[model samples]
Target: MRCDQVRQTLEESGEAYPAPVLHHLRHCPECAAYEHHWRWVRAGLLALARETAPEPSLGFARRLIRRLEEGFLPMRLVGEFFETAGRRVVYFTLLLATVLLLAIALPSSGPLRGRPARDVSWPQPEIVATRDYPIPPSELPGAGFSLTSESDVSGGQK
Candidate 1:
């Protein structure tokens, strides 16, 4: 059998080595070394399991519980609230202040506000009395046009 198969069998069988695994370990020095390492690990683990764990001092559990309870004071609850919701409140306040600052810093005559009334007056056209062309006033470009009836422009058609 292959070294991997033999090692897998040895691991699965725990302390019991099958005939094939024993034969493989006897021939393969690499597998024998692997088995030796695992034996040492198992022995150490068994020794740990057999040894007794150290006991805590008297009132250790009570002291730990008392300390845990003391940690949950009203001030601690307030601190937890500040840790969570306080950040959001501060951010919202900062955002509102920023918006207010922008509103105050911006010009009052922005597009949102109505345009200011301009005190500008258009220049009146001056009439020239030059004798260059003696054209009649009735023959002016816009003189023939008036607010006439629509029927007059439509050839009197109804």
Candidate 2:
């Protein structure tokens, strides 16, 4: 087997070498040296783990508890507020009222706030002008234009 593969297997299994790797290590000096080095490294790590374990600084637990409590306080307050049916109903009512007010006020405020001012005066010819254009008789056929009553359109009912 390759030295890297044997090394990975040794590192992972930590004392469980397969028969092929054991035979290969016996025949290969480079792989045997690597196995010896890895064994020494593992022994050192075990000794380190057996020695003094790490301890947190003073008040570390208390500070962590305080931070967690502070972070959750607002969420807890909101949860309590929603837990009561009255508060939940009141909150939804206010929200709905606000949405309704905005819906009504925004559209109606358009004429007051968004529209341009009356630039044309009351007697302005442009505003008062008729949209109609009377067609001249010359434009009509020899079945000339006439009206007997408002209903008699053919222009002349021929």
Clashes of 2: 0
Q: What TM-score, to 2 decimals, does candidate 2 have? A: 0.37
Evaluated with lDDT, which candidate comes out highest?
Answer: 1
Candidate 2 runs further than 4 Å off: 57-59, 64-158
- Give the per-residue lDDT of model 1 (tens digit) for 1-158: 88778888887788889998998898899999999999999889989999998999999899879978888456778899888898899999999999999889878775666665552444433344343544344433476665545446465433
Pairs with steric clashes in candidate 1: none
TM-score attained by model 1: 0.40
lDDT of 2 at 104: 78
Quantify all predictions' global Cα lDDT against the true fold: 0.77, 0.73
Residues 17-102 of candidate 2 have per-residue lDDT tens digits of 88888998999898889889989999999998899867999998898799788875666777877689778799999999998887
- TM-scores for all predictions: 0.40, 0.37
Give the RMSD in angstroms, all C-alphas superposed, for model 2: 15.6
